[model samples]
Target: MSVNSESVAKKIKELPHIFVILFCVIVLSAIATYIIPAGQYTRVMDEGIKRMVIDPTSFRYIPNTPVGPFAMFVAIELGLIEAANITFLIFAAFSCLYLMEKTGAVDASIALMVNKTKKNPKFSIGLIVVLMIILAVWGSTGTLSYEEIIAFAPIFVALSIALGYDAITGVAISVVPVGIGFASATVNPFTIGVAQTIAELPVFSGLGYRCAVLVVMTTFTIVYVMRYASMVKKDPSKSLVSGIDYSDFTIDDARMSTPFTFQRKLSMLTLFVGVCVMGYGLIFLKWYINQVAAIFMIVSVIVGIINRWSANRIANTLCEGLSKGVLAALIVGVARGILVVITQGNILDTIIHSCVGVLQHLSLHVSAIGMLVFQNLLNFLIPSGSGQAAVSMPIMTPIADLIHMNRQIAVLIFQFGDGFSNLLWPTSFMVIVCAMVRIPLSRYYRWIIPFYAICFLLQAAFILGAVAINYGPF
Candidate 1:
C-alpha cells in the first residue's frame, strides 16, 4: 500500500479504546469547568435518611473553583479515591471468583447442566430465563453493583457458548437482566429508596407499581435475549461476533463431563451459601462494598480449604483474578474522575439548574418528560443512581409540588431516567461489560441503540400513565 493509503488503513483499523474515550471525556470536562460557571446549593440534613440534601433554591455562584491543568491531574487522583470502594471490590471479588474457579466447582456444575441439556433448545431457553431471574433479583435487592456483576460475566459467557450461543447472549443473560431489574427495581435502596425519601414519601411504599414495571421489563429482556440466542444457534453466521475467534475460551462436552467431585461440590455449596448470606446482609443489614468484600474473602478461604489447595495456589489464583480485573478497575476510576472534574468545577448543579429552567412554566406533562430527559442527560456526568438522587431529587421534588404534579411521579421519572440510559451511555457500566466481553464499543453501541429506543418509549408511556393516575402515597 502507498503511504497515504497505509495511514488511512491504520486509522480505519484502530478504534478508540475505553481509556482513550474516558481521557477525552476527562479533558472535555476540565475545559467545561473553565467555561461553565461554578455554583452550589445549600445542603440541609435529612434526619430521616441521615444524609444532607441540596436546598434547590439556594443556588449561588462560587468563584475560583474552575479546574486548572494541574488540578485536572489532581481530580484524577481524587477520582481514584472516590472510586476506591468499587475498584477494591472489583479486584477482591474477582479474586474470590477466580479462587472458586480453581476448585473447578462452577465449571463442573455448568458442564453437568450442559451435558444434560445440550440437545434441547427448550432447555437452553429455560436456563436463560432462570439466569435472568437470578440476576434480576440480585439487582432488585440492590446488592449487585457493577463490580460484583463482573465476576459473573465469564461464567455466563462460557455457559452461553456451551449451549451453542455467542458471548453477546451471555451478556444478555448476565448484565442486561441486572440492568433491567435495576431500571425497574421494586425495592432497590440505592435508587428507589433514596429518591422516595428525598421526595418526603414513605420508603418503598409504592411497590405495586414498581413490581409491575419489574415484571414487564424482565420479561421483555428475557424474550429479547432468547430470540437472539435462537437465531445465533440456528445460524452461527448470524452472531455479532461470528468473525471473532473464541476457540480458546469455548466449552465442550469433555470439559463438562469432568467429574463433579466431592470437594468441588463442597466448594460450590460454599459459594452458594456465601451469596445467600451476602444478600441477607445487603437487605437487612444494609451492607455496602466493605461488607461484600469481606464476604468474598471468607468464601475464598472456605473454597481453598474445601479443595485442600495450598496457600500458594490460592494466592496465585487471587493474583490472576486481580490482574484480569485491573482494566475494569481503572475504567471505574477514570469514569469517576470525569465526574470529579465536573463536580469540582461546580458545573454539575448548574447543568441541573439549566435543565430545570427549560421545564419551568411548561405544563405538568411536558415538565415530567423534560425531567426524564434531564435526568438521562445528567446521568452521563453522574452515573451513580444514589449520587444523582442526592443532587437532582431535592430540586425535582419541589418542582413537582409547585406544578401540582405528584411527587411519586417525580420519583418514578427519576427511576426510569437514572436507569435505562445506563446501558447507552459510555460513562456508565456499558464500558465495563464491553471490556469484560472484549466486544468493541462501536459494535455494542450499534447493536444496543435499537433496544434502548424500545425501552425509552416504554418508559415514556409509563411516565404518562403515572401522571394520568397521579400515582402516589401522598
Candidate 2:
C-alpha cells in the first residue's frame, strides 16, 4: 500500500505495456527535475558549417526550474505539438497505404508475391534479405526514414508470415538492417557529415573504413535474422508471438481469389512508382515527415484514380486507416512527451556535462569508449542522429582533442551509440514498429538482445581499431 524503490522497480520491470513504461519514465523524469541540477551552455551559429554548435567550455549552472504537476500534464500536449510533423505523417502515410490496400492493388500484389514464394521457397528467403539490404542501404546513406519504414513493418510481417516466419521475424526483417546500416554511417550526411563538419574534417571522407563497418554489421544482421527464420520454420512453437493470432495480417480469401488482373497490375505499378518517388525524395531532396506525407497525399490521389475508387470511398478508407494507426501515432507523440519532460527540466545539458566530465581523465583509448557510452546513454534523451550530432558533437569534438583521441574516432563512437541504440530505446521509431506489429516491448527485447550483444562486441572492436589506426582524414 506504499511506494518503495523495490516495488517501483519491480513494477517497471514487470510492466509489459510501452505506454505505461513511457509515462512512468516521464513521471520519473519529472521527479528528476527536482534532483538533477539545472545548467546551460552558450551556443553559437557557426557560419563555416551553417549549423548551431555548442561552446562546451561555456557550460554554467543555471537555477533549477523543476516542472510542476500541472505542467507535467501540459508537457504531453507540448510534446504532441513538437512532434506534429511525425504524428501527422503517420496518419497520412497509413491513409496512403491503406488506400492502396482498399483498391485491391496491394492485395493482388501480396497474393502474387505469396504465390511466387510458393514456387521458389529458397528465392523467397533471398528476397527478404535483399529487401532488408536495400533498406539498410537506404538508411546508410542518411535517410534515417521513420514514417515510410515503420508503415511498411506490417507488410514485412505479412510477408514473413507468408514465408513461415513469425511477426517478430517480420519486424526484424525491416528494423534490424536499418539500425545496423544507420549505425555504420557510411555516408550519412546527418550523422557523419554533420559531425565531420563540426570537427573540421572533410565531409564523408572516411568512406573506405565506414563501408567495411557497414558490410560487417549488415552481414551480422542477415545471419542472425536468417538463423531465426530457419529455427522458426523448423519448429513454429519457437516463434516469439507463437500463440498470437495473425489472421489480420493474413491475406484475405477474397484477395486470393481476385486474381492479378490488368487493372490490378496498373494499381501495383502505381505503388511501385510511388515508392520510387519516395526513395528519390529521401535520397536527393532530403525529405522529412511533412515532405514525405505530401508525397503520400499525391500518390494516394493518383492511386485512387487508377482504381476508379469513389472519392467518398477513398476518404472513408483513409479515415479507417487513420483509426487503425492511432495507437502507433500516439506512441510517437507519447515518446516525444518523455523528451519534452526532460527538456523542460533543464537537466539534459547538466547530465551531458556531468557524463563528459568523468571521461576527461581517462586514457585516450578508454576515452574513445567513454564517448560511445555517453552517446548510448544520450540516445535515451535525444534519439535523432543529426540532433544528437548538433548538440553532442560540439562538446565531443573538443573532448576528443583534449583527451588525445582522434575526432574521426569520436564521430564513429557517436554514430555507433546513436544508431545501434535506436532499436533498443523505447522512445525510438522501433517502438512504433513494435506497437504496429503488436509485439510487446518485453518480448521484443528478449528477441533482440542477443543480436545487440553481438552488435556491441563488434562495435567495441571497431572502436578499438579506429583508435588504433587513428581513423582519420583529419
Candidate that would win on TM-score: 1
User: How does model 1 fare in lDDT?
Assistant: 0.84
The 10-residue segment of model 2 with minimum total lDDT is 9-18
lDDT digits (tens) for residues 212-240 of candidate 2: 99988888888898898899999999987
- Candidate 1: how large is its RMSD? 2.2
Model 1, runs deviating above 4 Å: 1-14
On residues 1-474, what C-alpha lDDT tens digit does candidate 1 reach at each position? 899998897567546999898888899999998888887788898886788789989988788488888988888889889999888888888889888876778789888888778566478778778889988867876777565776778888888888889888888889888888888868889999999999989998788988888888888788777888889999999987776777655766567777899999888888889888888998899888888888898999889878888889888888988987888888889888999898888888788777777777889898988888888898898888988898889999989999999999999999999988998998887788788778777767756888888888889888998899989973
Tell me the lDDT of model 1 at 276.
87
Which ranges in model 2 have alpha carbons more than 4 Å from their true place? 1-14
Model 1 lDDT, residue 326, Cα: 88
Q: Candidates' lDDT values, in order?
A: 0.84, 0.83
| Model 1 residue-pair collision total | 0
Backbone clashes for every candidate come to 0, 0
